[model samples]
Target chain A: MSVIIFADQFQGKVKKSALEAVQYGAQIAQQLGVPAVAVAVGEIDGAELSALGQYGATKVLHVADARLNEPEAGAVTKIVAEAVAKENGAVIVFAHNFAGRSIAPQLSARLKAGFVAGAIGLPDTSAGFVVKKNVFSGKAFANVSITTGKKIVSVMPNTFSLNPGGGSASVEAFAAGLGDADFKIKTVKVETVSGEVPLTEAEIVVSGGRGLKGPEHWGIVEDLAHALGAATACSRPVADSGWRPHHEHVGQTGFTVRPNLYIAIGISGAIQHLAGVNGSKTIVVINKDAEAPFFKAADYGIVGDAFEVVPKLTEAVKKYKGN
Target chain B: MKILVCISKTPDTTAKIAFTDNNTKFSEAGVQFIINPYDEWYALVRALELKEAQGATVHLITVGGADTEAVIRKALALGGDEAFRVNSDSQDSFFIASQIAEIAKQEQYDIIFTGKETIDYNGSSVGGMVAELLGLPFVSIASKLDVNGGTATLKREIEGGEEVVEVSLPLVLSAQKGMAEARIPNMRGIMAARTKPLKVVEPAAAETLTSIVSFELPPAKAGVKMIPADQVEELARLLHEEAKVI
Candidate 1:
């Protein structure tokens, strides 16, 4: 038996989350004493496929299908299932992103495997396959034990650090006989967010909220984000007021972000808002009100006017960067 | 067209989280339960809109015990034509999906709608598993959806941006924030909801493959290190030297 990792890519470029999944799968394989094999579908670079070895993949199964570029869940499931059968895979791993969220459950249903999504840590095989995951929107944690012969897990992105080592994987072509039936969902158009780091993949995030007052004052948030080379996010109220797009909203009803550093500016931390961001490695809150509730959850706090403190913080960051 | 919208009940966002029975069960005392916001605000509202726009029948379904009827009545008040409560309290995603899929297969719904994920478990698994069981195409995390004749178009968030996709009828979709606006039940709707049919059906045989061993709250934060406004630059120094994140 082997461990199979689905290495997801976007437009032929492998995502950093995919490498994190590879490392996670390799560790699981080590615990089980099995080889870890990563399966890459769609149009990806050969060099990128070989680099999977650095993240602990012993071999790479490349399904060079152009149609997979816009992954339809059904088609990708068929391909991943074929790879699993070929490798005699006992465990399947996916990065719990868009692709994994869309495909992993279908795969579990198809294979009748016990599946876990948004897993935050490694499985404890000593007592069956128990994995920990955030529940109640990160307010609590649940240790779930999968009691199936075959198991599937989707690791939350940024949960595991990527450690590249010295190695090269042997790439082999695998044929997945997919047809028109599997391509039921057709992509009509793609509009990608340009020139900005996506919040889910961002290591550092600078977020704003209602305390910023209006959309016109958003430059301070952007300035700090730019200085930190981080992505910009907002609380739900700011998005609801049209100060920012709904996609940039980070809260219980919006995106859940687990960045290395999260700076909440001009925001009072409501329970809903904290649910989405409490998983960040470090939290810094800046608010004029000392009892804003966000300060309680913050690692660092500066009670000051956003109008004055944010620009100064931006300047401080810029000065620290020597620009 | 007939649409089946899946509903789930979750604790209110502000409710204090606690566990009982050796951390295996959520403590419901003093907690107010509401229809999961994603379901009430997005999936069910969108289905109700489709019912008005295209003369479609919107049906609600939930996999829970008899106590969930109150939550189902609330959904019915929001304009669902009818609702079914599967008589099972299984929290297992696969088993829950199986029960729903069984009903959908017998009823032959042209559209299956669900929230992207329930706020309580945040699994995001049921919709896709239901679609797989019934051999239907599944589109997830759809922010926007429009239908024309037998074809449906949807907009969903990708890693960086959004993509527009098209699929034929008899499919499944999981709705997110941009799908629709939340609607509050009017007094008339509340009165009408009392007379609406809420059928409780027996659950199909399905195995629960996973079980929760325990639950734990996140560690409490060490008190915030308050810094003076003038020493804002020290925040940067601490982030760089102490936190080492920069």
Candidate 2:
């Protein structure tokens, strides 16, 4: 039996989180005294698939099914089940990103395997397999024990460092024996805002709240974000008011990020907003109100008007970076 | 069309999360519970909009006991026509999915909607599991969804992108942000909801696949180091040299 990692791909290219999953699975495989293998469904670059070995996969199974390219949960579930059966996979690892969140549960149901999502650390295998996950947003933590023999773990992105050391992986094609009837959803088109770092994968993020006043003042947040080469995000009110797109909203109801550095401008840091960003390694809050709740959670606080402080901060970063 | 929107009761976004009973149980005392924002804002609102436009019957469903009835009524006040409370504590995502799937199979709902995940548990698994159990197409984390004839158009958030997909009716979708705006309960809607039908159903037998072994609070942060507004350059230098995160 081997540990199978779902190496997620975007338009035939492997993503950073996918490599992280590979490394995680490889680590678990080492703990289990078994080989770690990766399974990629749909179109994939063979060279890239083989490169997964660098992240610890000893072998990569590429299921080049055209129908599996789109983000369809059912079809991917069937394919993963087939791959698991073929590889005698005892444990499956996935990066707790969009694709993993979509497909992992369905696979768990199909296989009756216990599943854990948003796992922040490696599993504790002393007595029984226990995985630690974020609960109550980021305020609390729960250690879950999976009783089932077959298990699925979706590791949170940016939580685990990617350690590349293994050599090349042997890539092989596996037939899913799937038909057109396997997929029912028809993908019409994909529209991306494009050219901005995804919040989940970004190392640094610059976020704005209602303190920025209106959409016209977003340039300050954008400028700081550009200066730091970080992703841009907004609080829930900003997204709800249409001052920014929902995708840029980072809060309890929005996307959760664990960037290395999170800079909050004009944000009051409500409990909900802090839930999403408390995972950041370092937090900086800039607001005029010294009593703003955000300052309590910030590693560093600047009590000033964001409109004035943000531009000066941007200039400072630009000057520091010599850009 | 018949729509089923799953609502989860969660602590108010501003509630100070606390745990008691040796940190095994979430402390409910003094903590205000509300309909999960994702469900109230996205799933329920979208369903209400569909009901208004197409004369569809929207039903709000939750898997809990008396503590959740108020939240269910809140959902109805926000615009659902009816409500159902599965009379059992949700054991886990699998058990919750099983309960929902059983009702959905018997009722043959034209569409099912749920928030991406509950704020408390944050397990984004129930919708997909229910879809799998019911043999229906599942679109997850859908930011935008529209129904036309027998087909449903949806935009789901992917990594750094959005995907536009279409599936036929009798499908399931997990609502995310941007699906719909949150609506507050008006006086008329609240009065109307007081008389709305809220049926309690016995939960079907199901086994939880996982259990919480223990709970702990996150490590406390160090006290914030205040930087004067005039010291912007120093702050940047500290970020670069001290925090080493710039």
Candidate 3:
């Protein structure tokens, strides 16, 4: 029995989450006294696939299928299930990403295994294989125990740090049993949101709210984000008011993110918005109003007019970057 | 077309989280349970749109006990044609997926929809498991969806940009925002929902993969710090020297 990890790929590039998933899967396998095997679907080059050794993948099962490039969860479920059966994986680990969240459960059902999503840490195998996860929209955490033979878990992104220095491993090509019907989900068109890093995956995030006055002022925020190499976000009201795209909204009703540093400008911290960003390692709130709730949760707060403060902040960031 | 939208009754976004029974069960003593907002946008609203366009029946399903009936009824009022309850609190995703799978097997739904993830448990698993169990297709976190001629068009987000996908009928999609705006039920819809049919079915007993041992609230924020409004530039200096975030 081995631990199988679905290392997600995008246009042949391995995502950071996939590397973290492998690192985690390797740890779990060590705890369970089993070998860790990884599989990558979609466009993956053999040479790049062999480099999975850095994350403790003993073997990489590369499935170069065009159908896997799209975001159809069912097709991935079948492919992952096939790999698990071939490798006799007692446990399967997937990054709790948009794709993993949808596909892990399906694979678990096909394997009749127990499943857990949003795992935060490694299992405590002192007793049963138990995993901890954030629940209640990241307001609370729950520890879970799995008593079944086969277990599936979707590890939360950025929860575990990726480990390097596992050295290069061997790669193998595999032909999993699948058909056109298995590729049931078809792609018609993918609407692209241009020139912004995905908030969920960004190491740093720069967000603004109505306090910025209008969409015209967005340039300053964007400039600061550019210098910081950070993603951009807006408050729900900002999105609702058409000041920013809905994809940039960060709140309970919007995108949840956990970055290494989250800088909020001219935004009051509402509980809903906090639910989405409370996971950030450090929070800095820059707002004119001292009564703003976001200040309480912030690791640092600057009470000032954003129009004045943001420009200065942008200059400082640019200076720091020596750009 | 027959569509099944699964929902979970969760605490409203503003509710103060607390636990009871030695920090075991979530305290419902004061918290208000609202329809997960993602479901309201992705599942319920989208279902209503489909119902309007295709003249199809939409059913609401949940895997909770009788207490969740009101929430289920609320879905009916919003737009669902009927409701079903699996009559068990399957906390584990594997167990809940099985219950949903069993229901899908019996109902044979053409399309299954759910929120990208619930606000409470945040387990984005059921729809995918149901799709797999039924041997149907699954697409998740779809921000855009269109149905035509037994095929579906969807726009899903990834780490960098978004990916557009197409799939045949008999599939599942976990909806995110931007799919559709959530609609509130009108008086007529509310009145009609009162008389709508609600079916309660027992769940198939199965061994669970995971069991919750305890629950803990996130550590609370200490308090707000104050800085003068004019010292905005100083804040920038502190961000680098103090926070070391820059």
Candidate 4:
């Protein structure tokens, strides 16, 4: 039996989170005295497939199917289950992102496996297969033990580091049954968020809240994000008000993120909003109110008007990068 | 059209989460509970909109004990026609999905709806598992959904974009934000909800594959360091030299 990981890709390039998943699965395979294999669907470069060995994958399975360019969760689930069965996989690993979330549980049910989603750490195999996961919107943690014969883990993004080593993974072609019935969900349109790093994979995130006042005053936030090479996020209220698109919202009721540096400007840091970002390694809060609740949770605080502070910070970041 | 919405009772978002019995159980001393926000704000509200627009009947279901009836009643006040309490104290997602699938199979509902994930457990496992068990298509994290005749149109959030997809009827959808606005129960709706039917059914026998061994709270943050408002450059230098994040 082996540890099987789903190395997700977009536009033929392997995603960073998927590399993390591969490394995590490789570690699990080491613990189980087995090999780690990665399965990927859609168009991927031959060099990229061989590079999987750098992440400890012994072999890579590719299904170069154009039908899966925009994968339906059901079809992907079938394909992954097939790969798992083919490998006699004891543990299935996935990066707990959009694709993982859409497909993991269905595969778990199909395989009668116990699935642990949003797992923050590797499983403890000493006693049993116990995994730690975030609960209550990161307010609390739970240690879950999987008693099933088959196990599935969807690791939270950014929780595990990608470990690269030297080797070449052998690639093999697999038949992913991409029947026309699986494409029952017809895609009418795709609205892409162009020219910006995805919030989930960004190392730094600069977020704005209602304190930014209105959509017209968003230039400073954009400028700061661009200067720092960080993704832009907004509190739920800002998204609800249409100051930013809904996809930009990061909070308990929205997207949860765990970047290395999270800068919140004009955000009062409601508990709900903090729920989404408290996982950040370093949190910086910028608000006019010295008594804002966000200051309590922030690693650093600047009590000033964002209009005055953000532009100055952006300039300083630009200057620092120049040197 | 008949729509089945799955609602779970969760502690208020502001409620302090605590564990008891050696971290093996969630403490429930005086915590106030409500319908999970994602279910209330998106799934239930959207179902209510469909009910009003197309004369659809919206039914709510919860996999919990009698204590959750109050939260189920609140969902009815927000315009659900009826509710079912699958009497079970188990918190396993598979067991809950099995119960929900059994109900869906018997009822022959055209659509199954639920929140993207429950905030309490934060496990987005149920809806997909239920759809798999019932052999139906599942649309996840849908921000917008509309049904016309036999086809359902969905706008779901993907990694870096929104995907517009269409599927036939009898599908399952996990609703997220932008699906519908949160609805407040008016006095009339609340009074009408008092008389709504809430049926309690025994759950089907299903085994749980996983169990929570213990719980722990996240470590508290160190007190904040106050940087002078005028010294923005210093903050940038610290970010680069100390934090090494930027």
What's model 1's lDDT at A315? 86
Give the DockQ (2 decimals) of all models: 0.87, 0.76, 0.67, 0.82
lDDT of 3 at A10: 68
Top model number, lDDT: 1
Model 4 residue pairs with clashes: none
Per-residue error (Å), model 2, residue B177: 1.7
Question: What's the iRMSD of model 2?
Answer: 1.2
Q: Which stretches of model 2 miss by more than 4 angstroms?
A: A319-322
Would candidate 2 be rated incorrect, acceptable, medium or high by CAPRI criteria? medium
Q: Write the per-residue lDDT of candidate 2 for residues B85-197, one digit (tens) a residue.
A: 99988658988999999888878899999999989888889888888888888888999989998899999988888889999898999998888877889999999999999
Quote each prediction's TM-score.
0.99, 0.96, 0.95, 0.98
For candidate 2, chain B by itself scores a TM value of 0.95
- Runs in model 3 deviating more than 4 A are A191-195, B222-238
**Model 4, total clashes:** 0
- Winning model by TM-score: 1
Compared with the true structure, model 2 gives a TM-score of 0.96
Model 1 C-alpha lDDT per residue in residues A1-323, reported as the tens digit of each score: 99999999998888888889999999999889999999998898899999999998999999899888988899999988898899999999999999999999999999999999999999998989999999999999999999999999999988787889998999999889999999999999999978888889899999999999999999999989988989999999998888998899998989899999999999999999999999999999999998899999999999999889989988888766777
Clashes of each: 0, 0, 10, 0
Query: Interface RMSD for each candidate model?
Result: 0.8, 1.2, 2.0, 1.0
CAPRI-style quality class for the chain A–B interface of candidate 4: high
